[model samples]
Target: RQDPTEEIQNKREEDLNKKKKKSAPKSSYSSVLIDKDQEPTQSVI
Candidate 1:
């Protein structure tokens, strides 16, 4: 039988992963910033 606490933790982690995938996560920030730097129009408001 699975321990309830471990199962709940795993489920919570899975939900977080799903949310990260659905939204743009900051882990991609540096690479995204580098790409954005190539085009400055967006940076300048």
Candidate 2:
């Protein structure tokens, strides 16, 4: 049988992993947008 405290800890870790996974794509998407925005300014300089 699993210890209840261990199970809760595992659930918390899973929640953190889920949050990281969700944020990872958002950050990458924003970075891509920033790169696109920078390219035109860099070329103009």
Per TM-score, the best of the predicted structures is: 2
lDDT score, candidate 2, position 12: 100
Segments in model 2 whose C-alpha atoms lie over 4 Å from true places: 26-45
Residues 22-44 of candidate 2: C-alpha lDDT, one tens digit per residue: 87966645666687865423232
CA lDDT for candidate 1 = 0.70
Which candidate comes out best when scored by lDDT? 2
Residues 1-45 of candidate 1 have per-residue lDDT tens digits of 999999999999999978876786654454565776675333422
> How large is the C-alpha RMSD of every model relative to the true structure?
8.6, 9.9
Could you tally the backbone clashes for each prediction?
A: 0, 0
lDDT assessment of candidate 2: 0.72
Provide the overall lDDT of each model, using Cα atoms, as 2-decimal numbers: 0.70, 0.72
